[model samples]
Target: MFWALFLLPAWAVAGSACLRLCLAAVRAAATAPEAAGDDRALTLYEAAFLSGGPRRVADLTLVSMARQRRLLLAHTGWATVVDPRGRDEMERSVIGAIGPGGQSRIAPVRAAAAGTEAVRGLADRLVGAGLAVQDGAGSIAAGVRRVRLAALAVCALAALALALPVPSDLPDRLVALWFALPLALTLGSLLIARMEVHPYSRWASPAGQRLLTALTRRPGAPADDPAQLTAVALLGVHAVGEPDLRAAFAHRERYLEEPAAPGH
Candidate 1:
């Protein structure tokens, strides 16, 4: 039948989406985190990286230093070194990122600090510990991207099928409905992923995510401390409950925070 011509690409779209979803499942299973059960409790830096990757870690450091009177974070989006001496490697990285002038916009500082060796080393440790996704297509985030692309493919295929000058007596509604099946397949998969994977899929492995929930939910949350690094680490600047703090980090530059694509 002439209608079979459009049907072929429709099948291709469905098949492609199915294949990609299957492969993603396999990868997710392979990477599924088994809790280490040591209860060692992640450091603030570690938790920051797991929660929102490098930028979060950098933010935690900046906020921590600011609270300790070592840095000044102005609501107008500037960072000034109050105490040039950094308390740790992470703080030192931020100081260096601020450059020789010791004063810079928060955006450039956040960007540079996020790309530092300290952040990469942190990512490596978390990846080794099964706490964060690898930064590439093998990751769940990448799988989602591929599935989205497949949905687009379905749309394009459907368009081509409609554009063809085929002689068929099929009703216009039926013809349109015919192509909706595969498109729905791919879009449906995305919806399922959003429901199932989402927040964890972005940056953390299952075990890490579980631990994070526990830590934040526990009595006297690690964040409850006066320093509050844990809060910022887990929830970004919003955790600070300070409008000035939020505005300071809000001017973040969109570069190098997560370099190897959206898999995180």
Candidate 2:
């Protein structure tokens, strides 16, 4: 009878977590358009967003600008506006995020640039074209968080079960062994999610992922293009090949200079 007290909640928590996690996973993958839209090929920026979202787009732009000497990225992790001109909306965003002082730490600049309307605008285009994940990113994140919370809840129930009186004739290990069923469920669910849910992630839908793979494999697609689209799109800044470029991004310091004085 006492076993009923804890086992009931344990099973409930475990079942709930798995259910929520599993609910839309298949739907999420299957719902996206499987074929390309309008025969449109993914642009470098679009590829970046599809592979790694807005941040990857920002990284791609930063790397592009740095290569052109329009923006100077130092090994010490600072971004200095060199051209004060943008060739596109994304370039303008990076410049604007740096502010009029023309200098700021790379981290904040990256965050601000990534959050800019220019980036979201790109997302809008991708989603409209059926290349980006249609599922709200917040939902995906919340689902993952709920699964984690459920794991903890299951553990709590197990503890409660152990604390309560054990049914006669059943050994303590036997009770734990029985409770292991739910514990195994939570762990197995987590492992399965890590593998199955990662490929599509939050940025690219199944169709978008297919496009990314196509871009990388297309004929005459150089391994190290001027944009480094494949590397940055797939791996973000970590794939940055330039030592100083990577160092500039890795800068974790919080630094934002004041706006330039009114007069020289």
Indicate which candidate wins on TM-score: 1
Best by lDDT: 1
Off by over 4 Å in 1: 1-18, 32-38, 136-138, 145-149, 152-174, 191-199, 223-225, 253-264
Model 2 misplaced stretches (Cα beyond 4 Å):
1-9, 30-39, 135-160, 163-170, 184-200, 222-225, 253-264
Estimate the TM-score of every prediction.
Answer: 0.78, 0.77
Question: Tens-digit lDDT track for model 1 on 106-191?
Answer: 78888899999989999888777767766735666767787788778777776776678877778656777877887788788888
lDDT of 2 by residue, 1-264 (tens): 576677788888888877876764754555535443735677788888877778888888888899888988887777889999898899999999999989877778888999999999999888776676665543344456667787788778767777876554566677777788888888888788777766535777656777777787787544446655567776777888889888787763454563353121
lDDT of each: 0.75, 0.75
Clashing residue pairs in candidate 2, if any? none
TM-score of candidate 2 versus the correct structure, residues matched by position: 0.77
